[model samples]
Target: MTSGSDGRRPVLTGLGAVSCLGAGVGPYWNALLAGGAAPREVDLPHLNMRATRMYRVPGAAVPEHPRRHAGVPLGAVPRMAVAAALEALDDAGIAGPDRADVAVVMGSEMGNASVQEERRGAGGAGRPRWTPLAVAGAAVGTAIGSRRGNIGVGNACSAGGYALGIASDLIRSGEASVVLVGAADGVTRVGMGGFDRLGAADPQRCRPFARDRAGTMFGDGAAMVVLESTTHARRRGARAYAELAGVAWSCDARHPTAPDPDAAQLVRAMREALADAGLRPDQVGCVLPHATGTALNDAVESRALRQVFGPGTDRLPLFALKAMIGHTSAAAGIFACLTAALVVSRARIPANAPLEQDPDCAVWLPLEGPLRLERPAVLANTCAFGGNNSSFALTGPGGTT
Candidate 1:
């Protein structure tokens, strides 16, 4: 998809990730192509939950320098965000004054929950007060030396997708030429306990689209991307991986934590995102679905993809990323988009995690091996608590400049 007449469509020029697979975009993509990492027992103190296993990032991969930012003590979540954001800026070849005016937008549901949890766990005496929940964006802004703005998106699991969309708007509207978009989260005691109480967490592993799928598993990490206007990238001679051609958001508001069984809003979001990108359903090569391993969510997304793609749904390759990295909550959307961008640039779709297909979820998911991405564009879906849904499209590098 070409940028609109204004040639201001957002292009993805750099990607950085910290995940269970490892740090950096290279390890993330390489591990995805190699069947992805498995979940392991995580050490979440005060988390009295049966579902303790998660796709936790390695200790060595997380950076520990810059322990404090703007007087706010940094925790794992903000530290991961800073690491990923700096990597993205470096990957994009953005430095010095060039980074000064770049805006910082981050989506985080639990923000610095680990910091708060630590304070509470330690009786909150003698130690400084805990950082705010929106500290990740500020942390990123300071790390990148950006004074333009620090915006936060709190749309639960779909926050990352919303952050990307907002960054695109910033560039297209001439508000900024370059924007840093990212998301990060660490395990939170309340989040885990609430999921356990609601019976919405899988104890063994996340098995989306499986006949006996239990519930989604939580993963912690950060992913960052550098989005720039097409003209800006060309001026700097930066190579783009993909064009963020379309972004659409919708709300179901049907339930606080459950998706609407009918999936009306989700289907609409997918269709509208394609329309926004000026793409036909047949042009999309693959999909990164928000199949959270929950029985209802997977089934609903399966039906929703069918509604949007119709007959093409049968042949489309669906990459169930959560099965590999577990659900990153607010970071899931950015993770999916990063995966989609890689799929578009590399022309290959990674294999989905192994599972026994559920007849109720009829969408196609190629688990045999890596498949060639034949089409030009890739689409991704992200839905969150309160039925907030987001869908976006990325086209091959050739579709950009």
Candidate 2:
């Protein structure tokens, strides 16, 4: 999975995350390895719902950024994005003149929805706190001084992966040498109410692929990754955590909220993504699935996995992060991507949280403890509303098969 002669391949140089586990990437990774849970009662009194549990970042765990946005009143999502973006840039050692060519691409399902709700609650008497462009991408671009461009994607839960794919395209097309890409989402009254109305909110913790799994619990968090062209990375002497081997997306277009039970589109996305990487299913060390814990979602995803990996699917390790961090919506895809990056870097798969394996989910889930990877490549999957599905391949710095 080396870059072409022109160094167009995108390599992951740095990662930053503000998850329910904590603010820094170290804490998030540690919590995943420890199989910790951070569930708390949802406090939104405005939303009427039976499912009230959610995974929230502690108030103290929120990173402070005094210089971000200066006098502009920043929303929680943008603030989290700025914090994560700053950490990513610092982690990548990308500063001075290198910052000028960077592009900022972020995704969010509910961009400043909380701010909008607040303004609406106030009867719009005061100055509005949010704008159409008050998304994570704008805030990150402002904070990082990215002159190339700022783009925001609102592709539901799959937006994060879409952001990464878009950034890679930008680099490959020579539109930008570097791109800061990821996603962020904060809880909002509208978001919670909508899920509750749809009966998709889990009353307890998220337990993906578990027998009694009811639904997904919402989580607040953000994740950012620094992507640079191999040529630029080499010229700047930057160390890479992983390479973005390949990414592909597809839409089922069968239903607006529920995925097609047949999973035909998802299978195509996975196969096309593998083809793009020029790798076989057996070459992948593990899979990070978008297991939302819902009965239909888990089952559909399992069928898709079986279709793509065949009998080998039963033996391939499946790492379900939503069980640990809850589903972060727009941030979910990149969070999984970051976890994959860590998995390849460490060569170990974090254990899926405790759960009674669902007979319906035919994939192998490592619940006992960490499972060591035999190879450095990982396939990360993400699916969203509107029947959108995305799959991407990531390889460690050592390269892929």
Clashing pairs in 1: none
TM-score of 2: 0.95
Q: Number of the top candidate by TM-score? A: 1
Candidate 1 residue 391 C-alpha distance from true site, Å:
0.2
lDDT by residue for model 2 (1-401), tens: 43444488888899998888989999888889999666998665555677878899877777655323545556678888888888888899998767878898889978767766776656647766555634567778777777888888999999998988899899888888899999999888787778878888788889889999988888998999999888888888999988888899999998999999999999999998888777789999899999998889999999999999999997899998999889999999899888898998889998888889889899999887788898778999999999999999998763555
Give the runs in model 1 whose Cα sits over 4 Å from its true position: 123-130, 398-401
| lDDT tens readout by residue for model 1, 263-291 | 99999999988988888898999999999
lDDT of 1 at 391: 97
Candidate 1 has its poorest 10 consecutive residues by lDDT at 122-131
